[model samples]
Target: MCTVCGCGDGEVKVHGHKHHSHDHSHTHSHSHDDGLHFGDGAAGVSVPGYSQERLIKIETDILAKNDRYAELNRAKLAAQEVFAVNLVSSPGSGKTTLLCKTIEALGGQPLAVIEGDQQTQNDADRIRATGAPAIQVNTGKGCHLDGHMVGHAIEHLTLSHGSLLFIENVGNLVCPASFDLGEDCKVAILSVTEGEDKPLKYPDMFTAARLAILNKIDLAPHCDVDLDLYTANLRRVNPTIEILNLSARTGEGMSEWITWLRTNLAQKQLQGAAE
Candidate 1:
């Protein structure tokens, strides 16, 4: 039985196997985690099921556990009264640069950032230059930031109440959408240089984002990209996604971005107050 949405919670007792009663509680999701182990190990003692089904089941179980932790973390964040945004973008999408500019635009406020990267502390260094508390989590080989990792980073930073926490998730759109890091919202940034077809091609990222920033509009004229089409594609995926066309380098449209941030923060604060 799967631990989440509970479907596969059956018990397993192998033939000619002697073991204590297996606890059927918390039926973890594994493709083969439905139980019933057959055959034997090299030692002639079957250690439960070890089939391909089991592997899939184990993988599902792991992700389910991650999501459970994520929910717990989200409730904790709600209690803390923080406006946390999980920002997702691809490599060279100007995520860090845009973040630095956003920090400046926000007037050096108490914004704490969690930088995620497979390697290098470059992004953290850039954020630190802006005088905000930036904690860089090096995933080393991981492509995205999971809820558990973000939870660990938040605990490490000792993030106080009423602070803006930006999680610059590892530069990937695919896996990040599946895991929530207890954020108030998820923001996705797509540079114009990446072309207008991104939203259509990467529907998951666009759909997951509460806001989609079409960055580097300063280079829009240089690229043969149709802004309207791009927006339409995104709108098709998520009709209510707030779209922002901005250039981080030229500072054009940044004020609007800042205003959006302020509004989001204000709304989050109000929600917290009401709660």
Candidate 2:
């Protein structure tokens, strides 16, 4: 189980094939005090029989291993000159709709998608309908996609050179913030209906993201959302994070989002050429 979030160490499947199992064995005493304090440790998370120090060590070890796999995935993407973006958001953020629109806008562009969800290939089916290649990774009880999972998924994709790859992560803001999937940058999607205090509520997610997209902006006025306050809160969490306001349904600010993608893709290609 994830020591930080307590998510299960469940079986991960990539496109219906069982990839592997996250069976982490822990040797801790079963006895515990009746008055349990799980937050008193330095790690701020306490397992039943594990001490705070042990929890910190376990978390550190897990992240360190993930980082190693992330480096491997990064190297693989670099070799193909792929500009990868990890799209992260909460449930009902309209990420899949925006992605479909993005695929339509970037017509004939060499691009693909890796869809992550707890269950179902529904989003992957949507992406494939755009005539682009896509892979679905079902994380049964897992809350987020780790670098190792992404590495395995990439093996099934035939990515073009100098292509754009989007990894639509599972709809959870907390755990995805800590896992790196070898993407060039993380893009956080927030809908106006979700409220402006999302950044403050999930500061780690906004802080880890390089760009923030305020999706469903067309509904802002109707929802009585203050766009200015949303931007302010995002800036408070990540002072240098780039913000974009767009509505996938109305195509209000989609052109800017497409431009951002092309600009980054060009930079990645240029970097590859220089190397």
Top candidate when judged by lDDT against the true structure: 2
Task: Estimate, for each residue in 1-275, the C-alpha lDDT of model 2 and write its tens digit.
Answer: 44346655445667722233322222221112332323213546656687777666566767777888899999999999999999999999999999999999999999879899988889988888888888888777777888888887888777889899999999999889988889999999999999999999999899999999999999987998999999999999999999999999999999999999999999999999999
lDDT for residue 146 in candidate 2, whole number 0-100 = 84
Query: What TM-score would each prediction reach against the true structure?
Result: 0.79, 0.90
Candidate 2 worst ten-residue window by lDDT: 22-31
TM-score, candidate number 2: 0.90
Give RMSD to native, each candidate.
12.2, 5.4
After superposing all C-alphas onto the true structure, candidate 2 shows an RMSD in angstroms of 5.4
List ranges where model 1 is wrong by over 4 Å. 1-56
lDDT of each: 0.73, 0.84
Report how far off residue 17 is in candidate 1 (Å). 53
Give one digit per residue, the lDDT tens place, for model 1 in 1-275.
Answer: 22222223232211110122211111122234344332212223334446555544555666677777788778877787778999999888999999999999899556788888766667888887887777777664456776766776666565577778899998886768767788888999999888777887778788999999989988888887788987899999899999999999999999998998888888887899997
Please give the RMSD of candidate 1 to the true structure.
12.2
List candidate 2 segments past 4 Å from native: 16-43
